[model samples]
Target: MSTTRSTRPPRTLVHPGPSPLSQRWRAGRVLPLVAGLVALVTACPLLFVALEATQSGWDSAERLLGRPLIVTLLWHTVSLAAVVGLATLVLGFGAAWLIERTDLPAKRTWTVLAAMPLAVPEFVHGYCWVSLFPTVQGFWGAALVMTSSLYPLVFLPVAAVLRRSDASTEEVARSLGHGRAAVLWRVTLPQARPALAGGALLVTLYLLGEYGAFAMLRYTTFATAIYTQFETAFDTASASLLALVLVALALLVLLLEGRTARRGGRVVREGSTARPGRPLPLGGWTRPALAAMAALVGTALGVPVYALGYWLVRGSSTTLPSASIWALTATTLGYALTAAAVATAAAVPVALYAWRRDTRLARALERTAYLTRALPGIAVALAVVFFAIRYAQPLYQQPPLLVVGYAVLFFPLALTAVRSSLAQVPHGVEDVARSLGTAPLSVLRRVTLPLILPGLGAAFAMVALTASTELTATLLLAPTGTDTLATQFWTYTTGLAWGAAAPYAAVMTALSVPAVLLLTRRTLGGTRIPREATR
Candidate 1:
């Protein structure tokens, strides 16, 4: 009898490849240089702003600080930020819970309506509400207008968290003999706290830098004060001094907010647990609830639309020329498009290097990109203007300057989006391609590019939207002859011709809606869709 041939398991394929140590060492040297460049660009402006503030002579700074009006302005700004922050937390959480958790009718419509105010710039809302009621100014007007415009920032994030939360936790609490109210108080709110807190922090920071609405309403906040000092006083030194104080205030908020954000890390759990519980029926409260909803939407969306539309129709008969509008529109589109492209491109390397090639230097570079967003648009624009005029005078008043300003102001949005999308991609796939002899550059171009296109699109859309709606920086840095829709609206409104200003406001608002819709829709759509489908 012949002995049976021994059978052996298929030999695993193994290849000796370049070691990671060698690759990392190579990247380490080059990455630090890139990181240094990024840091220099991002930090130089902040440093300059601080230097100017300190050097502007404390005598003037102290003189302004001694004035009663300045003290009152300080109080008003702080109070507005505090009150608006609290109001946003309450209104945002309540509205989000009602629309997302309760059996409220027309959840989708409510979502769209709630987020629509973002399309209406804070200034426009202030203008419209002021038009409707002259008393809506000062503290009450600032708070109401800020809340109406910003509550959505809180609502969107909280609603997303609410939709994905495991209702099973609440059900379990109820099964253990807890009441509905108890379950919510003990379980649901704790889970949603992080999103709420983060949203509140954003609202606070925005309020800190707010200018248009507060200024229009005759509210003397730091933002308005800084603008006034620059405009009325004809004193760059005092404005810089005030801007320093503003920056300090902003940094303080950011520092505390960062700690809170870190502490709430556990609340933002990754995987969804189960279908959310059905909304409690508002049987007796339905009429009152519906009426409240109507009022919210009517004031935020309806008034702006009505005022803008009425004025736009009437502007055709006035001195506002169509050619001027069209020209500004093209200028605005060019600035926005260029900014979007540059920001998206810059974010890719930062995100990719951070995600795939994690290293100390890479992470630092990524953080540097984000530093720009924290500085606020006005600071960024002003810093650039200062430097551009002093050093790169030829480039001043050029489109390229505006594009750079946008990239500096908005690269973080693109970086976050791209990095998040890249994180969702599997590393094993990249390994497989590498093992098949694909070059690193080729792999990134072919494999990573296709998967992250949606993120790039989303990022571009966001940057484009912000650039289009941007008022402060655009106001300061736009070419002498150029007028964006935002600037045009401001001009007409300031001239006491609400009828003429309405069209530009309406068009600007209308243009902004598509981007807001894209943001909310894509964001919520991603949450609603199955993860497997996303992959």
Candidate 2:
């Protein structure tokens, strides 16, 4: 009775569901808006190129397109892409099969070595090879350098798929009287098709956008043509026109890859259990396989290491001021760090929208973000320069401009990592959190961020590694008198001061090793050991 008389203040009703305003903000507007903004930023360079092309009128376009040189460039570009794509496919698939399926000795060591070339940028590879053999400039040279630099893209994914693949289907095929070769050709390769397609797409894209490597090798692809136009002629119209053609080529590759992937589709294992089977005995093939792998490692990883070492040793007497070296290193690190952080952060919204919304608009935005990457870095940098000079004069030759350019060029790398990480996180968890009256930001902070931390770190490291070695963009965008390691290396190399460039190149390579290790570890993390190894 007394308790009843003591009437406490009426409890305020609280809805368990998220507030209507918050729901509208998160479910309806926020992600799409953020994604759109990111997409718009990424599309700026492409838009500028388009605008410049329009302003130049059809006459300039026709004149440029009518040129015999354009045809030559197109042939060269297509040939290079085809050669590199096929070479990478073969090398990557073969290496993955040997390491994952056979009783290859030092599998772990081989795996790491196989992936090590990823640390060396295509430009660096070109520099190494070209420095050793100055005559190495043209199709053969470009193909050799690009294949060595890019094969890891194929190897990593194929190796991963091979490791995780359930061998039951393969065993069944074998029991059905299929030979090892038949099973491998029909069962194994088909299952690995998705990985192969993805890796091939990446290689093709790299060839399309590649400028530094092609430029160093004196190969005249569309990308190199655009760079030459910008540098020599200062003809924005011509460069933009060429860039549009390059974009078309890239889009063509994207379409082909999409169709191939869809046609191939994934092979669904019947059950959740994945049993790693016994490793295939190499027998008489072991020595030959090992020798083959050794040759691959020698070309991809060994050559670059030896080249750098030789340069460093040869340049020991060269007077590279300690202060200047440290300064350049610091500058390179700072720019790379800034670009990495900005790109990784910028990627989150688009990645999140793509992962969660699954709308046409979201898909378009995500695709648009990737479109810039398909453009050469030279094109991207020039577009940024054009935009900065026209609209944002204050940003001209500024570090911020350089950083933004880096983000545009490398955002795809971060997006790929972030989207993949987001895919692994279940949507139901976020829904549960929202139902429990947690705010969207709170859910992200508590559940999402913690879950995707490893992925974010990997993304950051990858973007940083790429930005540090970026040559054309840095050359165009870096503030006057500012020298990053890449620009400094280019200056010395261009001046035929190979010795002076060596220290910078060596340091760049050294810094890249850690990032490469981080990426390889993340890639290989999903791999399970064969039953034989565990035994």
Candidate 3:
């Protein structure tokens, strides 16, 4: 709406117009462009693998595809994904219900302990379990390791929804003479459908690209098979063939997840604080339940911590190649920091555009960011390799290309964090800035940026931690001699040199300690915010 002031010579009122193309151009473009470029580059390796696989004709594809080993690998991969998805869903839903619904003892403590599994990388956990019990080295071992590592993904999201979900509907159902079980199944679980599906999707995708745990546990899934084909057979074609198959599987999981998640509408927390649902009394099972929780925590957290410590102690006495270890650590940190900065910078506009613009284009771009997350690291690395060799041969083996791959692979972490943080800023603040005759850029710099800085930092740190531990892609695309901690740890662990692998794993876990602390602080701070502000 606009008004003309007749007494003031018909003063013109201005309406916000689309930003000019030139104004859209900023150093910010470098981030997404770099991200896009890395995505393309990572796409290359997979492309090469695919080309190699298909170029030999249908005969070769059929021969490779028909092998008993391939069939078993496919079975293992799918089974692991399915089982892990179910496991994570159960853990996520049950934990969320217990913590957010029931009168769980020390709810806050449980919350932190539950989510803390995410801090430990799957590979590290695998190493710990295998070290503790040599028998933990096969399909069952893989499932156990993955369940412990990935249940947190489901737990985090479902917990969030459960915490903020409206309880009135469930109460209403209860008032209608529905039994407790009926009310929960009919009302509560349905409300958590989207979050559960999303979490399951994440778990499935992770299982698809998994290498470390699979390798450590003697489970030869697609990821390990691809690596084996590449390394043992010296046949990138076979690996690419396998990778193509893996990509198809990932895509299928992703699509199914999307449908499941989209079935539920957005959950809204209405009115004032909703009472957390009462925890069902454990009755005589209290001690047993506590023991079960203890066992779960022990397998997931305790074994890993103890094993890493044991190996560190053992490795300390052994002759460690200090120069190599130090160099690898420095390289890992450097790449992580670079990727974090790039990812965080790239996530800003994508998030801001989604938050403020509300256009189809912005929405699509935000979704694109999520696409990379859903894709397996191997697929992304493969694509990057193909793109690099074809277009940027000079970048064929450069560290920059490697860093770019990291950013593309993990940008979603930054995007999600930034989006949540940006959502916290009230639109009224932006309106106030605009009313005060401030430009969009000024408002962004003065108002939005300051408010979201913590979020941006948190995003950067999260990405940094993830990038540092990324194994499969880093193994495939890292420069000829660059040894990341993940790759180093994998090499030693695979060689059955537990003592040597321990140092790298310990250092990696040790490096993540600060990040875990920061995340805990953030979690507590977010939870402690006024209930209204949380809304």
Q: Quick one: best lDDT, which candidate?
A: 2
Model 1 alpha-carbon drift over 4 Å, by segment: 1-24, 28-36, 58-70, 265-274, 313-323, 352-378, 419-438, 526-535
Cα displacement (Å) at residue 296, model 1: 2.3
Give the alpha carbon lDDT tens digit for every residue of 1-535 in model 2.
3555566897879756758456737665777787898889899988988988887888878988999999998899889889999999999999999998889999988989999998887888988999888998889999999999999988887887787788788889989999999998889998887778778888888888888778789888888888888889989888888888877887777667667766653543323487777898999999999999999999998888888888888873334443388888899999999999999999888888887887788878877776777788888898888789888999998899999999899998898878767766778878888778777888888988898787788789989999999898898899998988888788777766676788888888888999988867755676321110100
Q: TM-score of every model? A: 0.85, 0.92, 0.82
lDDT of 1 by residue, 1-535 (tens): 8899999998879876766545545555664565456556656556656776776677877887788976787798788889988887877787778787677888788888888888888888888877657798878888888888888877777777777677777778889999868977888787776677667766876787778888789888777777776667766666667766766676677556556655542332344345667677888887787787788778667877776666566653345444376777777888998999988887776677777677776756765554445454566787888889888999999878888888777776777668767766777877788677666666778998898898788788878877887787888788887788888877776766777777667777777888889767854673521111111
Q: Which candidate ranks first by TM-score, i.e. highest?
A: 2
Error of 2 at 287 (Å): 0.3
What is the number of residue pairs that collide in model 3?
A: 21
**Overall local distance difference test of candidate 1:** 0.73
Model 2 score (lDDT): 0.83
User: How many clashing pairs per prediction, in order?
Assistant: 2, 0, 21
Q: Give the per-residue lDDT digits (tens) of candidate 3, residues 208-270.
A: 777778777888888887777666777777777887787678667766866776677446543
Per-candidate Cα lDDT values, in order, are 0.73, 0.83, 0.74
Instruction: Give the true-structure RMSD of model 2.
Output: 5.0
Q: lDDT at 473 for candidate 2?
A: 87
